[model samples]
Target: MHIHASLRFPRRLVDRRLLLSLSLAGFFVVHSTHAASFDCSKATTAIEHAICDNETLSQLDSTLNEKYQTAMANLSDEGASELRKNQRSWLKERDACNADAACLENLFNQRKSSLQATTQQAETQLDAIIASIPADPANAAYQLKQYRGPLASAWLVYLNRFEPTSGVTAEEAKQRHQVAVTALNKQNDFAASLLKDIENDPKTSKNVAVLTFLRMTIEQGRYDEVPPRPDVHCFVFSRQGDAAYRAFGALWGSSRDSQAPICPPQGNLFELPAWKQLNKILDPVMSAAYPNSGTIRYASYADWAILRLRATLSPTDFLKPIEGQSQESPEKRISEWDDKSWPKVQREQLLIAIDPARKATMEWLQTERKFTASDASKASTAIVNAWLNEQLDYLSENLSTGDQ
Candidate 1:
């Protein structure tokens, strides 16, 4: 959770030769007679200036195309076709780049509108540009039609990548809220299973508590740990146990209160009857498998692995009770609460589940082995891909079931 905030530019930008070439190309574009003769000063308004610049660039583009075509006249038909295909691909990338620039400009305008002092100035400039543009109905209609195809395609691509389209009906808005809900539920189920496993291991209760504490520390965005002791595995025990314990108390105490409605009211917070019953069943099995000090320290971890496996195989009905608690219906309890509160808890829980291993590995690599950014990055790809695949499988399965 404690992401390093080093400002890194693209590696391509850092290459001296690439930088020199870019500088020369930029200089050529800036000093070209066709580019310089645009007469931007002649236009009295922003919109007029923009239009004039675009028109001049279009002319320059046409001239360049004519020269390129003449130079390529000796090429065979197959060569010409291949060249055309490459040109078309380049054009597609250029158009997408320009569209992204326009989108950023729109976003800037929106942000400017949100401030009291800048709002009037931004609105005035926008209104002046709108008023200055001549509204030719025929041209406007044609441009509007031209815009729809790419806009629709872009929207579909975005929805498919980030949102969901699996169960959307024709009558519904393209936004798939059900898909999002189902995905979140699956993640929550996974986190809950991991938590249950840790809580259920009586023989390794101290180790489980320590791990839960370390995980909570990471979730709270803390990363101030001394290098692992020569004799100790940092993942199993940290020198800064006090910091870890404090983080655990804060995170889990708050979570227990938040989830109180879903569990039976009990006086002993750590000894919830449902969880205690599970501990009794799992403790003996764990003790038999891990009889030594070194392996016993990892008993909680093995318990978590088993829980993760069981979570994948368990029926959806196992989660139904909590599902009802999480329902978005306009019941008094939910309607009065802010929507963001519960999700923030869920995010914290998931982060806590995964953070101990990540932090320990990072600490080991950085403090012990002196890993470079590239080295750490190479190691992280496998970790990230495995997590992504697990989440994707959960999403695919739940979506297929129409679980929402």
Candidate 2:
């Protein structure tokens, strides 16, 4: 994707042409006395003046022809044709390039805005942490306040030394610096609260717990420098209290069938039987992992469907579901030929498999002696991991069989 502009033009051709033209003019001016002293004013007519200028004009023309011949001699017929084709293609490409540049500019602007918003949110949360810090003499909060400034300063120094330049405007840099300052101030406040929590009631220290979570979250965020997968993080977090996660899971699950079927009948090869066999093995393992969640169930079902679809469909069709989902638009009813339909189908298939397991798991959790938020989160994480592992195993086994 990195483009070097210097490679586009032939510098040698330009250099040669410039040198040749100057040499020709210099030779005529130095060697020919009549050429150099041709008096246009005493010619008495425009045609005579023009005639007097012929020697200079002839030299210029000869130099140009030589340059042209040299350039042509170096080009193959195919290369010449390709060059012409590319020139024609460049007309369309120029507009596309401009549009792409505009899009990147907009994306950069949006990222700056998002960064500012995120920093503000973190600052607000940090302020709350500070306000919550108790003023007890033995409080960790008191000690934290004393050391927070130095820690924040050290962090800022590290960031300044190591972070890559973003090529942002001066105003943007100022805003980003302000955001960092705000974040640092908030961290100081949070540190004070952590100290207080430790001194008072260590068992129910929500502040300390949240701080630990945030530290882990920030560390993970740092690793995700490339085009991020924040959706996965959001989805995992939603299992705690976010209704949007459930909605997304439902939508994601429901859309699976609309994806291309794994085991569609094709010329001399029907993979339906093998797909069913694989599904039978996958079903129990998935059920154990995701006993009460439609999300995992749906995802597992889709995985199985993809395996079946791959057997009968071309590689292109196997890729179609992923491609179709990428188009962010309103969902439509499932149709036979519509690529978007596969996701819906896959989701439906997942729901059918997952709904029972989810109900059973919920019942089991309700009967447990200690059903706290932490316990629920742990359970969810365990289930998600198990489901992922089961699906991976099923896919691997089916792929090996299919290859054979």
Best by TM-score: 2
Clashes of each: 0, 30
The candidate 1 region of ten consecutive residues with least summed lDDT is 1-10
Query: Candidate 1: where is the Cα deviation over 4 Å?
Result: 1-13, 18-22, 35-347, 351-385, 388-404
- lDDT by residue (183-261, candidate 2, tens digit) is 4334343323332333244452332333232332233222233433222222112122222111112112222322211
Q: What is the C-alpha lDDT profile of model 1 across 53-73, one tens digit per residue?
A: 564443434444443342233
Q: What lDDT score belongs to each candidate, Candidate 1 first?
A: 0.31, 0.33
- RMSD from true fold, candidate 2: 27.2
Give residue 257's error in model 1 in angstroms.
45
Candidate 2 wrong stretches, greater than 4 Å: 1-138, 150-339, 343-345, 367-404
Best candidate, lDDT: 2
